[model samples]
Target: MTQVTLDDWAAMPRNRDEVSHGVLVAAPLLDIRHQQAVTRLAYWLDERLPDLVALAGVELLLAEEPLTIRVPDVLVTSSTDLNVRRISPSDVRLVIEVLSDGTVRTDRVTKFSEYAEVGIEHYWIVDLDALTTRHAQRP
Candidate 1:
């Protein structure tokens, strides 16, 4: 059987929910709690990073075919790419994943490695229940 790659997976309509650590990432609906948390944090970051743009409910396609991964939550990037299409993970400078019971590990471990591998400058994991956030940076 042929394996599906991230790009192929990206082309396929996604309607099923998947687990990304402790977070439950579902299609069609974006989580309210996660949205709120992202808003608050983005506001905090905006005060400092004036040239940066905060994006919510956006898709980050990290790979093509079977390796394709779409991240939901928040991302910080330069204002220039805000109007562009199909932003690649290579262009992503920072990624923030809000933690929930279904996808916490995926955020903390899986995505951490993936983001680092893709050369993302920073990765943030926010634990909603704990009311805390963890930031990871790559050198």
Candidate 2:
């Protein structure tokens, strides 16, 4: 498998690929329930944080060499620019992931660490199976 850099990942077509530890990986198709959760979260964030931007499925570039990238289900940021293909961790205020059977481990472990390392203030994991939301805040 060929390693992919952040720039390479960004240049690819949207909703097509992701980089995991510098390796290119295909993005999984989101199920209807997951989509619904992301939509609802975006709406809720928009209502509560009018000054910030809430987006769904946007690429969040976390690291450079041995590149790491993740697309959160829903993300809240103060950035106003919509033309950017990838966003830096500094621009992100919060990240939310709607748990699916295929991504439980990555969301809870891999992404959790990456988000924290980048100093993201808030992280939320919504587990549809358990009907609960787990929240984490950086100190």
Candidate 1 lDDT over 1-139, as tens digits, reads 4455544444666443432332334644547876678788877876777877777656676655334455556788774756753457776778887777666766677778877766887777777776554555462
TM-score of each: 0.70, 0.89
Cα RMSD of all models vs. native, in order, equals: 4.6, 1.9
Candidate 2 C-alpha lDDT tens digits along 16-65: 35687898867678889888988998988978997898998888888888
Model 1 regions more than 4 Å off: 1-31, 132-139
Which candidate number maximizes lDDT? 2
For candidate 2, which ten residues in a row score worst on lDDT?
130-139
In model 1, the number of clashes is 23
* Cand. 2 TM to true fold: 0.89
Task: Let me know the TM-score candidate 1 reaches against the reference structure.
Answer: 0.70
lDDT of the candidates, in the order given: 0.64, 0.82
Pairs of residues clashing in candidate 2? none
Q: What is the lDDT of candidate 1?
A: 0.64
Error of 2 at 121 (Å): 1.9
